[model samples]
Target: MGYTIKDTRHLKNILRADFILGGLTAFTGLVFFRPLEGFLGLSQPFIILVPLANILYATAAFTLATAQRNPSIPLLRLLIGANWFWTLLSVALLYVHYTNVTTFGLTTLLFQIVIVGTLAYLEGNQLEKMA
Candidate 1:
């Protein structure tokens, strides 16, 4: 079935929210990489690189959000998939680094996982509704 205008708007809003969040995360990570590295017991490259990727993700999200047509289902699925992937990776990272990760780092990672997982769930639910 075709999407309604309301559905498009809702999808756009969700993507826009993701864009803002990704931008913020990238900014914070880039700005505090050194401090984060020291506090999180994670490498500086990992800290720097993830934020760079976040910027790219934000860009894509912004583009998708501003699209003139109905939202692309494939792309939306990709975004949701990426979010889930990120959430899983974070959990794995937390497990791998459990020996060295500080409490602050653990909390930060957990927060990220929760946020991303929620976004994924929300996006997936919207997709199902659209379907």
Candidate 2:
């Protein structure tokens, strides 16, 4: 089955929303990483990975929001790629316990994966529909 023009357009709008949501998720991850670790006893990776991911996400959020306002396919494609990579890495690392991560850490990681995976799913669907 094919998507109608309206459906495609709606999906594009949804992609923008998804991007905005992803940005929020990233920002949340950035801010909460430390607090969650110190107070909540959730062990996360070291400085580089945590901050870097959030920074990237924040940057992507701005880029995607701009793309949505500007209606740029290239920008959308870039965001789609970023989301795929981010989600894949997140899922891969979500369960790896070679290091010492607490139960809270594991549960939080799973929760984060769900949120990120949803965003990825939205982005993928939007991209496919746009095609």
- List runs of model 1 lying over 4 Å from the truth: 1-6, 129-131
TM-score of 2: 0.62
Pairs clashing in candidate 1?
A: none
Residue range 1-131, candidate 2, lDDT tens digits:
33222345565566556656656656666677767665434455652365566566556555655553434556556666776676677677765652456666667567666766676676556543434
Error of 1 at 75 (Å): 1.5
Error of 2 at 82 (Å): 1.8
Stretches of candidate 2 off by over 4 Å are 1-20, 29-32, 39-48, 66-70, 128-131
lDDT of 1 by residue, 1-131 (tens): 64323467777888888899999999999999999998988889988988997897788788879988877777777788899999999999889987887888888789989988888887777765446
Top candidate when judged by lDDT against the true structure: 1
Q: Clashes per prediction?
A: 0, 0
